[model samples]
Target: MKIVIAEKPSVGRELAKVFGATTRKDGYIEGKGYSFTWAFGHLLQLAPPQDYGFIGWRKQHLPMLPQKFKLAVRKIKTKDGFVEDPAVRKQLDTIKKLFDEATEIIVATDAGREGELIFRYIYYYLKCKKPFKRLWISSQTDEAIKDGFRNLKPGTDYDTLFNSAHCRSESDWLVGMNATQALSISAGNRTVLSLGRVQTPTLAMICARFLEIKNFVPQTYYQISILLSKDEQVFKAISTANYKEKEEAEKLFVLVEDVASGFPAGGNITAVEAKPRKEPPPLLHDLSSLQQEANKKKGYTADQTLSILQNLYESKLVSYPRTGSRYIGDDIFAGVPDLIAKFTGHPDFGKQAQFLQTVALNKRSVNAKKVTDHHAILPTGEQAYGLSADKQAVYDMVVGRMIEAFHQECLKELTKITIQSGVTFVANGTVIRSAGWRAVFNDPEDDKKDEDNAALPKIAVGEQLPITEKSLLEKQTKPKPMYNEASLLKALETCGKEIEDEELRYAMKDSGLGTPATRASIIETLITREYITREKRNLVPTNKGLAVYEVVKDKKIAQAELTGQWEKRLEEIRSGSSVKDFKSEITEYTKTITHELLIAGASISGKLEEEKKAEKVEQ
Candidate 1:
């Protein structure tokens, strides 16, 4: 019998039902030629220092590099001490028994990086040598499962992927474990001040932004605005340049008012530029994009958004939640209309689904070369009725974007009007030519914009009109807004380079700070370590967090670019690059960073260290 191991019992049960594995047992289900079992995420992990005979924290054991990293069953911290979880152990035993008896194994874990780690760790930990095949599927739909079985790949085909995942785990263990120990020890050892390959740079982003905000000095400025009227329509335009003083602005404001009052034909409309603009529908969402959108629109935190999306995916209501690709391949695109059809009569999205049927599919989001791991998140065409309010919100976003992607462009007429009245006061307006795909969702006008989107009256070059009103407006230069979840995710997605265009940002995502699956956890780790706090929608660094940042700000770990480079290396490793070379680089860097962090921790928290020594001396 073939042993089919799934990532979770729920998924296992579904697969079991599909394969006729109806006989339920202690930790798995059994049927004809297949024994389906499940693992509760990761069953094993890299053993901690004490497990390797490094009994306690001491300076001499600073960089505890292991020659052969050992895998032990995952331990949970209890009141007595760290103990193996009984549930996890029982499941592992059942899996071991099934594997021992099986002629072959079928790996039915989540089809992603972390999922690979989960199964590989179990296989290696249990020391199973059976020939195995990987059953990779994007969704829990029965049809998808059937297709995956018919196309199972050699488990060896994913050996490169497993090596990549293993390297990531070991690299994190080496860097995070050593650096965290070194820094925590030097900083008076008061608390477990934590750091990680991804979390530290993330902390640095928050602290840097916070410091920028804390030190910003606002400057006052003034602008001259004149309200002009032509053909019974009035609109406002501001001075081309902001004046340093109100007196200068006032002087300009007077001249503009006089010039406008004298002119009959709209104050010499030197230039009236009108051009049609089309906004192609937004591409499907990757996890980060989804989280950013949810944060911006629904005020959900990054962690909250991931949790919701994950729940939706596990419920088989959506595709893989941890996808990084925002584009689907031609194969997936061929069936999109059919998937959208599932939402027909969906109560909320029924009309949208029906409308999308008539519109030609926008091939903008279809690119086979761009898709990796899994395609962008999409509804599984499963019933989405009865989702809680939050889940429904995310589900709606996925369904809406899919429908929108198949529609026409959102065309608008952009008009720029420049009036020369000793100074060029410019006015701009956008008139929607056709809502198109935007109509699939809510009104696009709901988004706030700095420019006045009021209708611009028809005017031509050389035409002049009298000014209706003129005034000097007082304004202050505003500092960069605090890093809200959305903006911060955007920053992280682009490695601190602020890019507004979706395609460019998506291109930069692979080289960003962390993987889509791990970024949410990184943010939460910062909060858990008390390194950052959520101030409303903003991620603010706590005092302890700031101090940690101060110590390591000059270090390599605090730089986002460093993390980006590491991300690139991980990708290289995933694509058949040598894991040994990557591990070697991480080991050397670990030594340097461990030393740097030790010195930094001592220098920054020297007073605390002295106090700690004094207390010890007294004792």
Candidate 2:
């Protein structure tokens, strides 16, 4: 008999069904030759400082770098102290019993970094030596499940992935634990000052944005607008030059109105340039893209988006929700037609699906090398009618993207017409020659991105139109908008670089501050630590958050480059690069950072002393 373990009960039951384990038993199901059990996510975690007898946090015991890291059962904080969760302990006992009785074990957790860590930790905790095989699948579809079983990989195949995950966890512990204690002691306050490798840089982005907006002084500028009409079609155009003073623009505005009063054959059109443009359908939605879209369209937070996507995945209506790749491998591409066929006449997407079936698939989204552990988030070919409104919305978004991915590019004509009035004023517009994928949404009103997307009436070179109205328009140079979850996600995706080289940037995107699966929680951690707060859709730094930023602003921890380099090295570790190089670097940096923070505390104290003397002298 073999034992199977999964990340959660919801997943365990799916694996159980595939293995013919029909007998429902205590804390697990068993039948035939298999026993399927689950962990409640993480049953084991790193031992805390107190676990090693370093109970109280003394300044002398600041940097606690253990020679051998220890593991303990996951515990929860109670009124008195931390204790093991009974449910977790009980489940572990059941799994241990199965391992003792089984001929071999099967590890069937989610195929990702954290999932790898979860299973490995449980094996070590239970002290099991049973040979195990790994079941790796991205979707819960019956076909995907059966296929994964037929192709079980060796448990050792992913050892490097485990190494990478383990390194990430331990490094966070070493730096975060030591720096947090050092800073707290230096501040000389009971308030626990939290610091993280990723979260600190993320917080710095928000605080810096807030400072920029807070200190901005708006500058007024002036321009001229001319309302021109040709063949009963009217459109607005702006001046080619800007006037620093309103009076200067007013004079030009008056002259333009005088010309319009006479309706002089529309200030002779000097040039008309028209070019065809194409907007290819957007790529498939990875987790970050879905979260950004949800934040922009439905005002959902990153955590809310992940939760909804996770629910959809568990319900078997969608694939995995935590994927980072937006492209699918050829293996998965062969099955896309079947998934799309399920929606043929899907009351909501039926018409679009029917049309997509006839279009040639653009292989830009079918590169196997671009796919990582999982493909892009996609539908499971399962019925999706019973979901709640929020779930339905997310499901529709995923399904709609699939429909768009296979359709033809939208065709449009971009026209730039220059009118000669001593100074050239230009009018720009785009006319959709063919809707293509845009037909999927069937909402022309919503398709318009700006005035640029509006249709332009037909006109040729040297063509003249009547100027019906003209005036001066006053506008202020606006500051950059506040940081919202959508924009922040984009910034994080690019590793906070204002990069235009797509290939270079895409290569470095993996070096972002946090993993897609963990970025939401990192943000929530900052909020829980009172470093930042949400004001409607915008993220605003609190006073305490700003002070923390100030102390670490000049330090390495608050810099994205430092965090990004660590992230890059972690990826190298995933590909079998040595862990010793990274480990050595982080340990040395930790000591230097601890010392700097202590000195920062002293510097702050000196500044306070000077302020006190200034106050006394004034008095």
Candidate 3:
């Protein structure tokens, strides 16, 4: 008998149905020589500090770094303190029995780092030595699933991936557990201060931005805008001059207006240039990018979008929703046509897919080399019916993105009209020759416009035109905007770098501060710890978050780049680079940071104690 374990019961039931496993038991399904069981996300986790002989919160246990972590069944907090979840334990027992009876095991969990760790930890806890194979499929379509089962890979092929996942879990445990405890102890018993690998840096970013904005003083600047009218065509041109005083800008505006009203009869026609530009459609939706777009358009929070996407994934309306890469593998390309056909009946795709016949599908987002454990998030071509409003909104985003990914690049003519009035004044306009992929989303509001350019009128150079109006516009230099969920996610992915090159961004994707699978949870952790709060669309840090930031603002612990470098080293460790050397390095760095944190905590504690003493003396 073959036993298959999935990450959740919904997915397990879907797979079971496809495999003809009709006999349903209490915790599993069995038929057609297959037994399918599932776990509710995580059935087991590492034991907490109290489980390792540590009692209540004490200053003595400032940095509770366990030597060897122990795995325990999942725990739940009840009126009677924390206890193992009965349902999870029972399901684990059932899985163990199935493992004991089956000759081989098939791991059918989600195809990503956390998913790998979920199954591996359970298998290690069960002490199962039976041969196991991996079922790696990005989509839940029957054909995709059948193909995956037919080509099952050896379990050992993913040892490096599993190692990386394990390292991530352990490192987060070490840093998050110790730092949180040490800080909380120093902060007093009234509050619980939490920290983690991703949450700390994310919190720091928010607090720093808030401080910058709070302390900023706006400065006023003045510019001259000239309105030129020729043949009933009124065009606006901004002066290429900035002045601190309004009087100076006024003088220039008057001078330019005079020059434009009475130009020399035969001023030479300077330059005429028209360039053709092609804007390729955006790559397929990864979870973070999709969430970012949804937040911008629908005002949904990051966590909200994540939950909606998870629902869509469970319904099999879309592929895996947690993938980081925006590229699909070559093996999946052959299935694109069939998937595209499913959209033929979709309201948004019926007309758009018809035009797809003449469009040259782009190959930029189809590199198999860039894909890791999972491909990009896309619709599974399944009919999306009877979905909730939120799910429908998210599903539309996925389907639209998939259709856009395969469509032709948007073609446009960029016209730069240069007119002179004592100085060079320019007006620019973009003429959309073809809508191309943009036709998928027909909403005019959805079009992202470039605000720097002005719409240009068709006029030859050196043509005499009357000056319609002139004005000096006063503008204030704006401070950086507060960190919203989408921008914050982008910043985390880039590790604070503002790289404009696409290839470099792709190269830096792996070393991003946190993996796509965990970035959403990291943001949630900050909110749960009361370090940050959502004010409308912005994520502002709390007073406690600001205090923590003030302490670690200059330290490497608060910098995303430092964390990214460590991630790079961990990757190196997975690829035959000595694990012993890596462990030594991590140990040394951990000890160093631990000592620094202790000194910092002592300083904070001393200040609080001194304040208390002064209050008593005053009384």
Give the top-scoring candidate (TM-score). 1
TM-score of each: 0.95, 0.94, 0.92
Clashes of each: 7, 1, 0
lDDT of 1: 0.85
Candidate 3 lDDT by residue in tens digits, 276-368:
988788788888889888988898877889889888877768888888888998778777867777777788777777666555567778999
Give the residue spans of candidate 1 off by over 4 A. 258-266, 445-448, 606-619
lDDT of each: 0.85, 0.82, 0.77
> Against the hidden true structure, what lDDT does model 3 obtain?
0.77
In the order shown, the candidates' Cα RMSDs to the true structure are 3.3, 3.7, 3.7
Model 1 TM-score on a 0 to 1 scale: 0.95
> C-alpha displacement of 316 in model 2, angstroms?
1.2
Preferred candidate (lDDT higher): 1 or 3: 1
The window of 10 residues in a row where model 1 has the poorest summed lDDT is 257-266
Clashing pairs in 2: 266-465
What is candidate 3's CA lDDT for residue 457? 60
Candidate 2 residue-wise lDDT, 1-619, digit = tens: 7888889998899878876789999889988788899989988988998877777777778677777789888998899888988888899999999999999788888789999999999898888887789988888878888898889999999888899998898889888887787777787744678898888899988888899999999999998877778888888777889889988887777666334467566566888889998877777888988898889889989999999999888888899999988889998889888778889977877987887688767666788888888898899888876788888888888998888877778888888888865456888887789887788766463444333427678877787777877777788888889888988887776667766443455566678888788888987998999889999999999767777877888887788878888888888898999988888888888888888777675444444445457768989
lDDT, candidate 1, 246-342, per-residue tens: 8877777766744346645436678889999888888888898899889988999888988898888777788888998999999998899898888
